[model samples]
Target: MKKIRAALLGATGAVGQRYINMLDRHPFITLEVLMGGESAGKKYGQAVHWLFPDAIPERFAEAQVRTARPESAEGCDVVFSALPSEVASEIEQDFAKAGFTLVSEASSHRMDPDVPLMIPEINPGHLELLEAQKKARGWKGAIATTPNCTVTGLAIVMTPLLDNFAAEKAIVTTMQALSGAGYPGVPSLAITENVIPYIKNEEEKVAKEAKKILGAVKGGAIVPHELPIGISCNRVPVIDGHTETLYAEFPKAVKPDQVARVLERFSGLPQKLRLPTAPERPIIVRRENDRPQPRLDRMSGSVPGMSVVVGRVRNGIDERSLQLTLLSHNTIRGAAGTAILTAELMQKEGYIG
Candidate 1:
């Protein structure tokens, strides 16, 4: 595989910084251009409110942040947009219209009819939509998006359940981390020692994005899975990882051991292709009753923070139902890591150079 040059759209923000951290020594992709809004003219290190404990890699720290525009990304093989949703809508479109292929972590285009809302493991074939996306949108480039942070782990867990045990409906309750809100997120007065019961739009985004991601690509578009989903989202005091408790109904009786076996063995295209960012095991099932805690299990994987960890697999009220708890790193698996995996998949599948 040839080395690819990549540009980032929101280089000074939280998710953008995660891209820098993860891409610092990427096998093929190189972060050549850094773009930002108010921080556009300053060097990345100087402008960012750098969140991670580790220092920002020196190269990216010194890289000057460019204004978010298509020309700012000239010569780059791909553009990764980590911009906020409201602003990402316009700027990302401008880049696509200008011929820059984009892999974004923004919510603006996730539900678009032609655009792919991807979880590479769950729907690699969805990338096929990019071709029609380019044609229908009348642009040389196309956008491929990732699911909402809250949806990533839940959807990953649901995939095997639905396929193996024929799970018919899901009831989910999430205790999300503060980092999911981005830097300086959830004010001290608002979130300290508090569990905010609501995060506007999170529940809906989770259900819709999960369905689309788990959907099958048909007729040059995706036919979303029609699984019934009931979700209750809440913001917790944790700093990373979103934890969700899921209760699912299946068509027939299924055993906890069977569900554990299926989930623990799940893997997809990225794994088969041996993509650099692909986790050795996308799902890790724990047996202990008090397992999959956010602090301990969020980063549990060969590829750290990339796997969804499940525990407490058991029966629900009836023999035809199942229950489990899941945890995933909100900023990593949920944001930057998945986007990078999508980029790697794109490169492998010849969607990008």
Candidate 2:
């Protein structure tokens, strides 16, 4: 099988760097193009300021970075877009029309029925709608996106319960890392020792994206569920992982141990597919009381690519709900890792050549 040649738009930014590191050894993809906005024209090594401890891989050192525009991405079989939402909406649509499969991390096209915004482990079934999307838009390729980082982590924790029982509503509070905003994101004065109670559009993204990800695909389109997620999104001074506290009310009465068991042992459709980037466990239920801390365990092997670590499971306010704390590598499992899994699903399903 010929290797799938791919491009990374927004390749000079934080999320793009994660895509680079994840794709460094990807069995199915070749990093054929690296495109950025202001950072265009530099080599990948120079364009990117390495933050994560992992060194930049040799394959990407000399790769030239170009303008992250559609015309510059010629010859790629798929384009994993880590571009900002506004920029991504434009470039991704053009690339899809140009006949390249677009697995995007941007939220622009996420709500479109034609575009499948996915967390492969939680909702691989949604990708089925991509066929109708392509035909409707008269495009050669389709777009599949990962939900927002907070949504990705939150949804993974909810899936097993949603599958076994039914999720009535959820009240969540997220302490999102500054990195979610991008490189040089929050200024020192703003976040040095502060916790801003509100993030501009994050709460909306978390609420809306969760429903789309948990939605079902029917008649070649997704019908989003009417589940309500009351959310509060905050920007913390933390550098890497985003942590979320959730109170999920289930229709059935399930214990904390039951939730732990479900999260600990559950592996979804993506794991079964054996997608190269799919983690063996999508959600790791940590037993240690203080586990899943950003500095100590956020980058742990549980997320070799696709896992989300969830710990501190306990009873919620009432008998009908359960409380848990979850953590995910903002750029890895939340951004690039999910994008890679989306591409793997597209490849196995023959969306890409």
Quantify all predictions' global Cα lDDT against the true fold: 0.93, 0.83
Best by lDDT: 1
Per-residue lDDT of candidate 2, residues 1-353 (tens digit): 45788888888888988888788878878888999888799888887888778788876878788887777878888898988997778778888887878888888898887778888777877888778888999988778888888888888887787887687888999999999999889888999889999988888888888888888888887888688889998899898899888888888787888879888888877788777888888888888888778777676664463668888988788777888888988888889988888888778877786
Worst 10-residue lDDT window for candidate 1 reads 213-222
lDDT tens per residue, model 1, 217-310: 8888888899999999999999999999999998899999988999999999999999999999999999999999999998888889999999
Error of 2 at 108 (Å): 1.1
TM-score (C-alpha) between model 1 and the true structure: 0.99
For candidate 2, what is the total of clashing residue pairs? 0
